[model samples]
Target: MRFKDKVALVTGGKNGMGKAVAMRLLEEGAYVAVGDIDELNIERYLSDFASKKDRFIFVKLDVTNNDSIRKCVGNVIDSFGKIDILINCAGIMGPVKPTWEITENEWDQLMNIHLKGTFLCCKEVISYMIKQSYGKIVNVSSVSAKEGNPNFSAYSAAKAGIIAFTKSLAKEVATKNINVNCISPALIETRFLMEMSEEQKAVLLNKIPMGRVGKTEEVAALIAFLVSDEANFITAQCYDISGGRSVY
Candidate 1:
């Protein structure tokens, strides 16, 4: 029970890695608030994990909307009194195309959700954290952010921004006992990877020297550690979980 009595908020936790993280936290004795635009997916967790229903709540959220984020945070605080951990996981892979081929709207959409959404969530929660003088934030970044891909310019840029934001924010709040860090994964075999084209998939796989895709559980485990008191001495770092593909 690593997170006994603590409350955690996770965005985009319908399926894939987000759900895995949620379940891990719950098993470790944390109350989790699940937020997603897909009401059905978010609610599915309640019914599917009925045994742990007491540890979970669902909120309909569009992270890009400030009002929506504010209310979502409010709802979490109302339910659990305080938020001990914030996981910025709600993001989408932008249009798969070259930089020039990507539309301005697509670029804006990626930035809005991944970058701006992180900002909004943190802005609303930071006050609560500051008051408590304790907090943990883990933003999900991508290896694509570190090593540029062919057709994911918008997505890569947004994720890269998350890394930078995590470091900067962590530094600002270190003296206050709040830690911020990010995990950059390569290919975690989530639904997003299934959505890739054959050519794109091959290109990505070839980049990985390990010759295999990563698992959601692996990322979840790392995330669990990052939020634990054991990681209190760690902050402002982007750990690469890309199966040795990110060797610089």
Candidate 2:
């Protein structure tokens, strides 16, 4: 149980990679609070972890709202007494269209969720982590952040901001025993991929030298390592899990 006694809070934990990470941490023995706005799927998420209900909780969270984030963090602390790890996995695949064709509202919504949301969650929890002198934070960026996908201008920009934010925050908390990092993954097998058109999926898939997309479990394993004691010395780094799609 590498994560025994650790308390982790995973935003967007209702589905996809967030759900996978939550399950991995729970299996490793952590009190996990899942934060997400998708109440409709809570029952299914609960069922997936029926055997581990004692260590799992579902929190209603709207990442774009500061109040919701504050309340969610407070609820986790109240229930677990402390939060040792934070996975900022909440995100949306914003408008996939030409830059000029994207509406202002579309751009703002994407930035608010991917960038501002990460900032808010970190802001709400860092103080508690500082008090304990222990913490691990992992923000989920995308390969688009590094490669600048053709039709994903806003998403690319927001994810790039997440990487920069992760680096800056890592440095800020370097002395407090808190490790901050991010992961940039190319098209993983998530609902997000299903949302794409066939041509879009094919275009992305063809970029991978490994000839396949990444798996949620694979992403979870990387996150588990980054948050565990094994990665205590690692911080401010963006690890790419792109199936050879990105080598830098």
Candidate 3:
């Protein structure tokens, strides 16, 4: 129970790596509030954890909107009394095309979710964390950030921005006992990956020295450690879990 008595807010907690991180935190004894827009998945999550309803909540969230973010954070504070850990896992794979071919709307939407969303959430939650003099934050980045993926200009740029954002926030709150970090994972086995074509999948697979994509549980474990007291000394770092795809 590394997170016993703690309260965690996980964005995008209804699916993929976000959902896995939420489950991991809950299993470790934290009161968790998941902020997501997926009502279907929210319903499923509630049913799955009906017995632990007291410790869990699902708030409809649209990270791109400041008003929505404020409401979601407010709901979490109302229910949990405080926010201790925040996982900014909300994101989307933007247009997979050449920079010249990507539309302006596509670019803006991608930036809104991946980069601006992380910034907004951190901005709203950091004050609460500073007030308590303690917090842990993990932003989910992508391997594409470090080693830019072809035909993924917007995603690469936005994810790279997340890394810089995490570092800046970590330093700002360093003396406040808050640790802010990020993770860059390569293609993981998720619905996102399933949506890719077989040719695309094989191409991505060949990039991993481990010969397999990462698992959500594996990413969850890394995040669990980062947010726990065990990682008190760690901050402003980006941990890469890319099946050996990225080594620096």
Candidate 4:
């Protein structure tokens, strides 16, 4: 039980990679607090971990709003008493369009959710972690961050921002025993695929040297290791889980 006696908070925990990470953490003995905007899938979430019900709690979260973020963190600390790890997985695939054709509203919405949301969550939790002098944070970035994917400029920029932010924060808190890192994943097989067109999917799949998209569980395993004590020496690094698409 790598996470025995630890508590973790996962945003976007209702589905996809977030759910996968939550399940993996629970298996290793952590009290998990899940935050997501999708309430419709709560029953499915509960069912998926009925056996570990005592170790999980679901909280409503709208990452774009400050008040909502504060409330969500408060609820987590109230329920679990402490949060030792944080997985910033809340995000959306904004409408696809060329940079020149993308609307101002579209750009703002994407940045607000991905970049600003990550900043807010980290800002809120860093204090608690600082007080304890120990914690691990993993931000879910995308391969698009490094590639600057065409027609998805805003998403790319936002994720790239996450990488830079993670590095900066990691340095500031390294001495406090707070390790901050991020993962840049390529297209993984998940419900997120529903947001992409077939052509878009094909274009991405063609770039993976592995000849297939990655799996959520595979990415979750990497995340599990990053947040566990096994990775205590790691900080400020962006690990590529891009199926050989990234070499640097």
Better of 1 and 2 by TM-score: 2
lDDT by residue for model 2 (8-95), tens:
9999999999999999999999999999999995677689889998898999999999999989998998998999999999999989
TM-score, predicted candidate 4 vs. hidden true structure: 0.98
Q: In angstroms, how far off is 64's CA in candidate 4? A: 0.8
Predicted candidate 1 versus true structure: per-residue lDDT over 73-96, tens digit per residue: 999999889999999899998799
Which candidate, 2 or 3, has the higher TM-score? 2
lDDT sort, best first: 2, 4, 3, 1
RMSD of 1: 1.1
**Poorly placed runs, candidate 2 (over 4 Å):** none
Clashing pairs in 4: none
- Residue-wise lDDT of candidate 3 within 1-248, one digit each (tens)? 99999999999988889989988988999999999878974566688768778899999999999999999999999998999999999988878879999999999999999999999999999999999999999999999999988889999999999999999989989999999999999999888886777887898889999999899999999999999999999999999999999996
Clash statistics: count for each candidate: 0, 0, 0, 0
**Of the candidates shown, which would achieve the greatest TM-score relative to the real structure?**
2
- After superposing candidate 4, which stretches have Cα over 4 Å from the reference? none
lDDT score, candidate 1: 0.91
The 0-to-1 C-alpha lDDT of every candidate, in the order given, reads: 0.91, 0.96, 0.93, 0.94
Give per-model TM-scores. 0.97, 0.99, 0.98, 0.98
